[model samples]
Target: MFFEEHTGLHIDDQRYRGSGTSKANRMRGFWTVEPDHVVARVLLAMIAHATEYECVPADMDDALFADVHRIIARLNQNPSSPVPEVDAFTASVNELDFEAAAKHIRTAIEQNEPATAWIACTCFR
Candidate 1:
């Protein structure tokens, strides 16, 4: 819930705008102190560096969540990698169920999967 509480600080519509340079900078301020924010920072950097057009809130969310689903599916399908937490989180995300995602995020945090916690906070918002 640490990242959840901080979501209001930088996860606004404005943060998803522009080329993501500003958001990446803002994310640096957090990840420097809290390494979990590296997920958000890296994602923002991808937008900032890879795209020619300015980023939009809905587009960014959709692209990110779409890839999230793909990654989760790949992980879940691999018999050697049984990630039930990721499965639950992806299920919550697929349903657009923010409350359920939050619970899974809390579980992720407790499980020490900070990257998942970051993704849940950034996407579910």
Candidate 2:
């Protein structure tokens, strides 16, 4: 509903199913086709719609901002194994590379999390 209402992109069930072959995968395939910013914006909108608390990423504090990105990264990750993004995230933590870890989190959120969240929105609607 949000995708069509806001972004004008219809979610065909078959096509969407292709995005995540199984329920456990959390829909990583959306990034392979859609633009990152678009997916992020749609996810943000859906969050605002459901929570009634809109977030402006620029207005978030540094820690809060990074935390949100990390949350998103975690949600998008496969439960069965570590993906490259998760590996990089773990390496950054092991090396105490705060900036690199933050970058990895942000990139993972931008590329994967939002799209997966958008798909999850279907359950509610």
Candidate 3:
């Protein structure tokens, strides 16, 4: 996986600490513009925000996953809700950058969606 291949980046530890041993347990992300930081907002969709997995509670996974999928689809098809920092980074990427794709994601996070942010940062770590 992307994370295992890049273990040298030290992103795994930053993303997960005292968390448990499940997909959700390792959702807390350590995002930044740097290679390892990974732009948290883009990560929010993966693992369905980790909220479903993180809590290990009951039935919450269903809802979280639904929301995550919705967010993912919206980003894939929509063009208006760009992430906050996308314009600045676009010049550097080939133009189809996932990093630039993170703008809408950042907006989603602004709604106090910590679970999404956590999942995003850790998903590709």
- TM of each candidate vs. truth: 0.26, 0.36, 0.25
Model 3 has an lDDT value of 0.45
By TM-score, the best candidate is 2
For candidate 1, the clash count comes to 0
Q: 1-125, model 3: which lDDT tens digit per residue?
A: 44444323444564454455354455443332232123323454334435555854565568886785676555444434434432343333345345633544465455544346545545423
Off by over 4 Å in 3: 6-9, 12-29, 34-58, 74-125
**Residue 12's lDDT in candidate 1:** 30
lDDT of 3 at 82: 35
**Once superposed on the true structure, which residue ranges of model 1 sit more than 4 Å away at CA?**
1-96
TM-score: which is higher, 1 or 2?
A: 2
| lDDT winner | 1
- lDDT of candidates 1 onward, in order: 0.52, 0.51, 0.45
RMSD of 1: 13.4
